[model samples]
Target: MDVIIARHCVAAGEDGLSPLQRDLIEHPARIRIAEAPTGAGKSYAFQRALRDRGHRILFIVPTRRLAQNLANGLSNDLQDAGWSRQKAAQSVAIWSSDQTAVLRSQGVASINGVRLLQMTDLGSFDGGMIVATPEVVSGLLIRRRVEAGQAGEGVFDMLEQFDHIVFDEFHSIEARGFGLAALFARLATVQLDNRVGFGVSRISFLSATPLDLKPTLVDIGIPEEAIALLRERIVPDGRPLHGDVRLSLVDSPSLYDLVLDHLNEVVEELAAGRQVVIVYNRLVDLEKDLPALSRKLPEAGIDPARVLVINSVRDSTAKGRHQGGFAIGRQRDPLAYDLILATASVEMGVTFRNADFMLMEPGFEAMSFLQRYGRAARRGANGRVIVRIEEQRKPWLRAVVDWVRERPGERSTIAALTQVLSRSVQAEFSPHNTASTFGQLSSQAKWCTALYWSVLLEHASNRQPRRGHLLAHQPKGAGAFYRLEQRVRQLADEPGLTEQVNHWLKLFHAQAFDLRTIEPKIRVVSDTGEAYDYPRVWLQRETEVFERGIETGDEIHIQGGLDDYWREDKDRHAKRDWICHFPHTTRTLRLPCDERLVNRWCDELEDIDPYEFDWEDHPQALEAVQKLVRLTGLVPGHDPEISLDAVSGVL
Candidate 1:
């Protein structure tokens, strides 16, 4: 059945390039958004179109696994384009922080002169197909320009070389990355302003769902016309390439219980020679559930050996091997495993052609729902998708589940969810606010901070000079240095930004100076003149308040430098260091009651027996009782301490 369905899917009629692909090949927009279905051959079409245009491609994705998949997919395309295996492998370059670190640790200069490209090594990213994470590419686009640095110039040079920069799986990017893509495009505008060249850098956002296109592009300074260029090319609906697939939404208190409730059915399906995949979004949950599920499967008459756990957090080399092995195992032997437990790391790009069932613990985010469910029924295989969610817990999630339940097609489901999300976001949006970004700090400053930290961490690890001036080494060639000099001159005209950057340089140099030493500590004081010390965290916004000394009215203090002082008495001239004396803890008095007015009051007493108490003359208790009597204005029926239940029984 699987082989027959696979053949039918391969032989399905819509085999040529999509309309969007033909449009891109004929008249590519400066910035284009392509919306297409998963199995519509978008990747192949985009690669071929860009190649025909004589443009080097730089494919950026959200995760490492997707990068690996694209690298392999593009390599096959290169081979099909009449390139040798060795040459094809050399043409595709992967730039990631992890891969670069591995290469550096082995004492190798570069993988064909492509250093990690994280730091100032943008030259290696000169030509050919470069696949990188959003972090790396975004960092390069907005790198700081300095008088003695050529990194900024290197960035422009690399930008000029690539005609098309595609962000695949655009919907999966977080706010930071999505914003960075916008910033990257905006910076390209500045790059174009100074270029004497004849080439223009184009951007393509390829996704199955480009939900918030207008708002995203507008936030990044892209004009409305550029956004109107979004071309949607999808497979026509109601085509029968595979058998009828079933998708059910299961609501349960928890994913664990959902699995147990269907344990017999799962066992029966596995026993019938069907492959099952249990998808988890959390690693901790997967680790806990995998063993429990494995242990319980035996009682249901399923072999434990047929169950396997695939984790993404293992060592990178081991992780790649395991992912590759899983893909191969699935393709070569469809029923090799009865149950496969995986995380959302495999939700995109990777194919599981033979899996007959998918049980997903849907993530909290609505955007990822489509990608997770799309894993099932690949290559037209008949399959079932059961999304187990705690419906009562998350209202927004329940709304999305209901939406998906109503729409069977992937595109329609995404569209409805997108509209729902847009309304939710728009209702909360304030038009009075001029700034698009909804925070105190500017977006530029945030990008600067991200770049600053990446450089700071890298410099500290490489043991490079911490001094900002000394950090800028000489460029390799004259052309890059010349461009760097010109860029520096242009930046020197803004005095306000120049002054702020000078302050930032001093701060960076000081931090670099402390890189080799134990970080300094700050002393804090409580209201009772108690002193406590803790190591200073560079970016800590809130002071740590800890309980010290005995439990007898514990004192809390604001921990900081000697400048933080407080005056206990306004009349006194001397001020006490608040870090040592002014504790932030609140103080309250405790009074113990010696007698209970009724038997029902005995349960509220602690560490003392209410029956044997005799404190008629207690001053604090007398005051409390007097206050209660005045407030209520109720006279005692018989004796003030007598139980009302006993009186009622007598009546």
Candidate 2:
């Protein structure tokens, strides 16, 4: 199949307005869902619709980096529209965890002159723009509810103050099990019910590749008719908003090897003065292959300064090596670089207007795949995309490849392409699966809900008022909140358990109910005295390699010994231990800094029983045992023969 799709010259509409821009201006709805192609000006349209209306806008994105980018853009838009620079800066604020920390400590952190504000500041913030991640907004809502012991009236009032709430990249909401999508649905339902009069905030969801979210919204008690779904029409006679992307699919077992195979091609592109972007799925792979790429690029007479690396890692010391890698939150013009290497961090919200070619690993989901591709060929310049797929790992890529092949020489609009890719990964991208994932709360979400509701009930006393709010639409009685309430009550009775529960509650609330177990990270000092933090799990995996290197008398970049560093000062060790243990509640046991002790603790953590816990069967027992572990600082039963009942007395 030829990757190139024939382009046709088409004239823009007489009014030069996209369908979304026209709808926002002429036929505004309370709940609007817009699906448009990348660079179609969806965000700009939404901004323009709300501009001069004196409407308080809450623009929610998936990541903090995107929030920063959008906040900067919005501030600039306000300035371009005739607002003074200082006034525009003051109007556009960022509300994210990092910004929250800064605000709490220093009252403000400026991003491109825009003030970063706290959740408490929202009440007094008048008719301005606030950019945030869903986690930050949802966490604020949940935290307010638990703390105030009511229906979170303070947070709700703050939300009501916003004239419009826009969720950008809204497709990300369908993340499985207690994700922002599900949490937002519940929050939106509650807010809709609680709002009594006019001046309610309009909710708009914007996505380049949108999922069918109407069913999920309706399932969670949102009115079906209230939603206004607007899809961009593929105007055969109209010019494409984005550049025509020529895609090439490559199946390989190793993405690194595949990139190496195409090194000469990359060099050729760079030598031809074309901007190139290479995206890796894993940071480890990027780190490993970067040195080789750097060496070869310089040898090919390409200036080393032209190469730019962007990843999650922030290494100020590596400026001389990679021309100062672009870390998250650090602004740079990506188009300035002749060659770029990045991870998934650059996939969304970041655009490379002048990028002529791209070599990328296939993303896990279809949305991510499209998002990665969308980064290039922007600004109406034709670009080439080469996707390296590990078919054994991502078998869905084969289906997508076959689908494209079956329709050889076909010209597809962005909407049509989205449909084909989404269908290829139906289980993940389908509406049914999205609804199912949203309906079912994870155990951690259930635990948090039960705890919060129990606190709310303590103050409200009447259950009827609380009904139809807070995941009430789910089957089996308001998300089994009552069933889990007893467990929460029992655990609260345990000594110090209330404090522990509150700590965990705050942590989970801040994380937006995401309770994925994260490995403790420790800063490792390299032989060159450069320090970098690595997860304990990664270090554990590398231990064998380190030991084998030591036996063979080979020099290793990372020294296995860390006792000296830990022993340098007692306060240092204490602080490091606190940092490592802060994110966790009951997932692991705390141990001293001895290497042997760390290994033993890791083994013990692995050996602990999972309890086969179901929300319906053992809600009480699971909560009890989890609380017991937190209180006792010990796993209930390390031995397989011991029953959970045997540890009930410990609680």
Instruction: Provide the TM-score for each candidate, comma-separated.
Output: 0.56, 0.69
Q: List the residue pairs that clash in candidate 2.
A: none
What is candidate 1's lDDT per residue for 345-413, written digit by digit as tens? 666655553666778887655445556665666555666677776635355466655565555454333
> Which regions of candidate 2 deviate over 4 angstroms?
6-16, 22-28, 50-52, 100-127, 144-153, 174-199, 251-274, 315-330, 333-336, 391-393, 407-413, 427-479, 487-520, 525-533, 542-651
- Model-by-model lDDT, in order? 0.46, 0.54
Give the total clashing residue pairs for model 1.
8
Model 1 scores a C-alpha lDDT of: 0.46
- lDDT tens string, model 2, 1-651? 436533322244565666666675455466777776666777766566545555577788776667766777877787888888877776777777667666567754332122213333432433577887765665444332232233334334544576667788766653222233433334444434546223456677787766666655555445666678876665555655656777777777666677677778777877777778888887666765665666666676667677767765532222324322322223444556787788887766766647768889877766677778877766567777888867464555666687667776566656556666666555544445432121222233333433333333333322354333433434222344454334544544555556644444333223223322234454555555554445544444433323332322222345533321222222232211211121123443444433343244434432443452223444554554344233212221222222323322221
lDDT of 1 at 406: 58
Q: Pick the candidate with the highest TM-score.
A: 2
